[model samples]
Target: MTISFSELDFLKPELGAEFTGDGVHFAVFSAHAEQVDLCLFSPDGKEETARMPLPKREGDIWSGYVAGLRPGTVYGYRAHGPYDPSAGHRFNPNKLLLDPYAKQVMGELAWDDALYGYRIGAAEEDMSFDERDSAPFMVKGVVQDPNFDWDGDLAIRRPWTDTIIYEAHVRGMTMLHPDVPENLRGTFLGMCSDPIIDHLTKLGITAVEVLPIQYFPDDRYLLEKGLRNYWGYQTLGFFAPQPRFMAGDRITEFKTMVKRFHAAGIEVIMDVVYNHTAEGSERGPTLSFRGLDNLSYYRLSPDDKRHSYDTTGTGNTLNVAHPMVLRMVLDSLRYWVGVMHVDGFRFDLASTLGRTRHVEFDRDGGFFDAIRQDPVLAGVKLIAEPWDVGDGGYQVGGFPHPFREWNDKYRDDVRRYWKGDEGMIACVSQRLTGSAVQFNHSDRGATTSINLLSAHDGFTLADTVSYDGKHNEANGEDNQDGHSANHSHNMGWEGPTDDDGINTARARRRRNMMATLLLSQGVPMILGGDELANSQGGNNNAYCQDNEIGWTDWSGRDDPFVDFCGRMIAFRKQHGCLRPERFLNGDNEGPREIAWFGEDGAPMDEEAWGQAGRRMVVLYLAKVGTNGDTGKILDQLLIVFNAGGECELRLPAVNGAQAWTRVLDTGAQAPFEPVAAEETVKVPGECVLAFQSAS
Candidate 1:
């Protein structure tokens, strides 16, 4: 039943007659506002002068029923209240605003003083009120008619232990693909095409964790600098999909992409940033949240109402401790899961969601508890970045159960060990084994540690070994924007070098790092372009780079590094013993499944762990079964590493193993050959090697 705009009456409504149809039911939650007006635009978008005041005001919510206004109708709201910033009220009846519950927003906002509730250059800036009608400068929300046929597509809830996550950007992944059509290059359809699916399937990753797809404003600052927000962290609308990613049809294209991915036996996880909105601060524009109800939606300083509590460092953090704000987040998550068919979400700056009015991390915060007890959300994956810029914000391994955390310790230790930082044997061993000391408590299994070496926010694997410091002059920030503590060592020279010795060392280090990440006992997450040795020319923070530096360049298809990535991923999937659900201990059910050995083929000594200049060796031995069936082993893998200048590794002999075959040699050149079983191979220095023992 589609109602036409003429049949709808906003001045009065028949309460008993249930409006059981897809029409526009305008509603705005403004606690301080006295009245609200609904303004509708025409079809051709020339004359928009129709206005109707809301008939009912229940508590702070102003709602009215519009009968004939169906989907695709553009509309904005104007709330009437006192325009005083010192009293925490920045409302102006003439200024138009976007609804916080809008499912779809049309048009981009033009930057101008008319969009702000106060004059820009006034002496009291934001404190001086302006009487400008912002209907022309604001984006109008569309009343969408939601319907889609899933065709038996379901979320593949792969177990946490066997899951391999691949972090990628939706646009950057397929923007350069030759197979995707030129018209659909950066759209949702492009990512769901054969080229992208084939690459993900071949890599053996169970999940593709994409960056932010929510509607975000292309910042005015980025435009001024001739750059883009390539990462999509600055969100404008929490519920609506970004219009730029939609092609042909708008919302249906996003649903089709999710359905296609699910049909391919892969799960989709979204990287969501609910910590803050695009409305920067007091001086920022009057976007949705700030104009709706600034005091209710944002966390203001307790003593000083003029300032906001900015734990997210991206301006005002959302006040999730508020009941209504918590409901908004939970509603959005459930809508995405049940309606949009998303598998999970990775929260950006998740610590901010768990903070209270006191600015302390509460385990049972309103936002966290609401999602935990929900029947629909409890079944899906929940990952946390686990930190903010506030005091005591670094809660690396301090999250509760049912929440996996990004293990920064694993990343730091892996870089230090492979870069030849001595006296790191103990820390390296702990990281390789899933950092059991950090996650073993509170019933969180080994999979709780989402191990990753390089992510979208930092340097790629190739850049980490090539440059010691970030050269971000290309960002136009005078090389002062990115991180200062890189934890990188440039073998001998910085950046690219003509010296063969230095280039060879850099290549070996990339392979070694990839091998370690896949072989580690945890849920491994691979950065999208790291496999192809993608470099940003030593730019650690390329959040604003949308060119070749950010996109996946397929021109290097014939490069040896591309083949190395495929081989390393295959090795991890073929070996079930590498990714264990439980931590390994010397005294488990029977004999030790994992045994660490020193250079002498014996248990490592404490002295070797403390030596500042010594680069030690480790041997991983897995016993097949429990007590009696231990002798009937399936296969044993030996991983040897020589980080020092050169060393001769004495291979450990297994009791029932028939022969040892060399499967991987990181130091070899193009078209590497595998040695036959029982062959005594020579291992090179500063390289990693892997062998399979079969009976």
Candidate 2:
């Protein structure tokens, strides 16, 4: 099946190296390159086999076919052009670049001065060009076979009302899992193993929002300190999965994991970082995008094109405003959804993506409009971090319809209220109702708010009540890195204490917060390992800790707390009133579907809501309305929250309800039976209780 070089086809439309049975077709986008050469390497990816210049150029793409090249061919690209940094065109023929559309990347990026386009000690810095070859230090792209046996696997598009996201790291999830095999641990195969799937199913998780699996490089500074980027936020190649996460050098391992998850009725949601790349500012290495078309790929400074317009706080931000760059991002997304079988994506630093060419955030930006109209992407779940470190970038509830945003407001206000902060009752109420003040417009539903208590960037749920201040000295940042205003309380002691009373208080606090997250009128996202009471030893920012501090400690899990979380999830699923499709309000409508009450068993007045010292509040949810005649009425639920000292609260009486069964009590940690509607129950401090009406 070998063909000669004269039989090469120069009209291939697809980018990257695609195998076509008899040979491989190479196509790349480099708008500024004077010449693009396809550099081929040996089977071991060490020695250069051949360097052939692409024979054809149509628009910005350079394409050519290499006869007799097989699926396992190792290749890279070298663009020869001007190295003028001031005008933002950095093209170095010595530095081999990775294909932006590469599906399979091989080898680790060895940090060396040779990888950079400039000399390390040059006084001119990035402005001076170096003639050293970057092939030995750079990573190479491998031609991949895109065929996979899906085995009748389709997407599990669970509705937003029923989706419970579990944010997990592909490696940190199963790294310390006892049941996982040694060889499979910290890999894609281990994440969807039998034990992991069983645990998620029992916990009632519908989707797993996995952290970045895209190909990224380890930071030189972190590696110098003997640490690694445990959280893969720095993306190098969007189309390629992280090579380390695969047990073997095969892209099909990720598909296998997805197939297994689908078999268990679980959806895979990737946390994608498209706002920036691993290549830093102008001084950074000439990696894939930086060397290809610097001016076209990055948002360079309007004043000085040598510098980057960094809205992501990362050194460089992707210039998605450009048509070609936008196409690349959209293409990467479609490739993931169409070929990888992933069900959703949580865009990291999404505000950067929503920014217009003028550097201001726009809800109707090109990125949003393009994805909203995309046929393949519109059906998949889209979640956004909703903000970046740029100016006016904190867009918590500012996203459009069908796009859910991570609600940091919910996390902070919930933490403050549970920590006994004054004047938080009002703020907590807004969060409980899905932050209606923020996201109630534009026909958006209550589930637009992705409610979360703790995530990967901050302290774990167990540490939230165990550490009053961040302990991030291990991050090599001198304890000055993570947020100082944590809005956290250490109960009576800091860190892990030997006292039983403090441990009990911490456990109760975790339960209260977890219950609040699940019972609220929004989509709940449980930080993975929170159910087992996982801790990072008070280190809120363990982004560089690849050791035990980052991995989930399965052996030291609290079995009782795990059971409590599982029960809470199951309870949330059983009751549809908790996750309402529409926002609940008391406008004196027909039958009054929802009502708020104070501790006195009466309707909450304006004075009660404005109380600075009020910590006890009641929520009454009923399905009664015009639909009652159609037999669509559901059982009513009464939820009570007591964040202050122990107090007695009289239960509110509802129509056609005789007895109320206490299904959940977060404080007592024990079983409870039914109580009458008129009975006054004593609620423990920092507790959450939910009662179901039995007619």
Candidate 3:
């Protein structure tokens, strides 16, 4: 595969492994490299076959056209340059680099001390450069052809208004399922099987917001601790699909999953972590970007270039302010949407991506501007985990249009109110109606809020009511790693209870929260196992626990919970008022809209609306009529919240309606069964009631 830099097409700056008829053209960005060698490995990825130098450097890119190289050709790079850590140039030719644009990787990195650029036992720490070869322990980028029939596959493009997200791990979702086949069980095809599809459809989820399926490294620390990084947040390669998720052919298998999901009318929203790489601080391994160009790829500290200025709380933060680095991220996103046929993205630590050169987060930064302007990305759903672990990182309400942010405010307020926190009515009211206080700006509609009770990083829905404190003991961090401000409350007894009364209370509380989430006015994201009453025994932070602790159990133990979720989801879809377009300004001009009421069955005054510690309230919704006019003529709903204690609700008369029908009663023995909404309905304490005006 070796050729003279002058003889072949070697200087083309398109960064990636590109298969041209016969040979594959490889390119990488390393502005600081004096020389870069293209190290080709054997098909088995066991040994290095040849080392060819790319003498031609166009701008920051080093590229070469290998003559006989074809698809599945494993390769890495050794960029030759200065080894000064203080200067932020930690280039050691011995360390192999993965192509930033690698469509697929051939092997998994085997953790070893030899993989470090510095000697393991050296006193110089990172200052010492080891001459040992890291090629044997490194993973090589596979030269994937990127040509799939696709079978006319296209983006599902389900609007955010119509979308209900289900956050799930590719492995954990179907890993322990008795229905999914034994061999296919934790793979991509396994999740795409009939059983999973039926479950999602029944749950009324329009999109599967899967946990990171990108190529990631199982960290050395987690491995030593006898745990695995199950969440896959620490990304190793942004472009490649995780090889572990594939059963047979990687590209085809992934495409098949997406295609099958599309066939089921379900959109796939990939949870991508572009904010940081798996490579940690100065002490971490010289994997990909760190080996390519450390200073150019990572945000090094201004005072000390040897240390990284991390914002994502991951050991290193990507230097997206750099144009080429920014381009790499933009290119990776496009590849996922265009090539992979993914409908959208749920960006982990997304605030890190929107960081500007001035060390502050800006909505109109390069990362955002690129996506907004790109034709491919503009149409897809863009969700942000909106905050990072840096200064000015809590930007929950600051994202621009079309970027739905993860609304932590909604989660906290909802949890606090249901857990019997005083003075939560004001905040809870805002959250119930899409948090208009946070998102009512710049034409940002209700869909701007991606509301959730729980996600992968925190407690699942079931655990929230079962544990008052985080139990992350399995992570080997002394049970001190997860969030302390959980806003959770155990119902009488803590963990599992034998008392029928306590279990009944916990079950009702779960229903209360689920009903609140589904009936709320925003894009509701359900944690995968939540609908089935899944719990991790109070382990809020199970990021490193890849075993049954993190996997969802599908023993149908919570068939009642599942049925309730299905009915509620259907009820949400049947009504238009739940997912309104504009903020309810009390003008109620259109068809589907809202009107607030007090316990006295009268219009809520300013004092009543803002009153704290008020546990009971009434909300009236006027759904748009079927005649298709501006008038709100057709449907009407009366939602009641009684969190304080058991009380009788005198149903409000909406437009002189005679009777109301109970669509959902969280306190009832059979929550989903149709019950006639009486004039005075008795709602139990810590319960939520949904009623529609009977025609």
- On lDDT, the candidate that comes out on top is 2
Cα lDDT of model 2 by residue, 426-497, tens digit? 899889988999999999998999999999989899989999999998899899888887788899998988
- Positional deviation of residue 419's Cα in model 3 after best superposition, in angstroms: 0.8
lDDT of 1 at 557: 47
- For 1-695, candidate 3 gives per-residue lDDT tens digits of 44433366455546898888778787888899899998888888888888888856787778878777779888888889988899999999998888888888776789998789998788968999888888888888888877888887877787777888999999999889998998898899999999999989877889999999999989998898788888898898999988888887566788889999998899999999888999999999998888889999999999999999999888899999999989998889888887889999988888898886568998888888888888989899999998999999889889887889999999999999999888887788899899998899988998899999999988888889888888888888898798999999887778877899878888888898999998899899999999988989899988898889999988745988888888888988898778787776566444435777766667778888677768877777775654565464566778887788877777776566678888777877777677886677777777788887787
lDDT at residue 583 of model 3 (Cα atoms):
72
**Better structure of 1 and 3 per TM-score:** 3
Clashes of 2: 0
Q: What is the lDDT of residue 396 in candidate 1?
A: 80
RMSD of each: 3.4, 1.7, 1.9
Ranking by lDDT: 2, 3, 1
lDDT of 1 by residue, 52-136 (tens): 7877777666777766556777777777777766666777777777777677777777777887777889997878877877777
Off by over 4 Å in 3: 1-6, 10-13, 588-592, 625-628, 656-658
Q: Write down the worst ten-residue block by lDDT for model 3.
A: 1-10
Query: Candidate order by TM-score, highest to lowest?
Result: 2, 3, 1
For every model shown, what is its TM-score relative to the native structure?
A: 0.93, 0.98, 0.97
Total backbone clashes of candidate 1, pairs 3 or more residues apart or in separate chains: 3
Candidate 2: pairs in clash = none
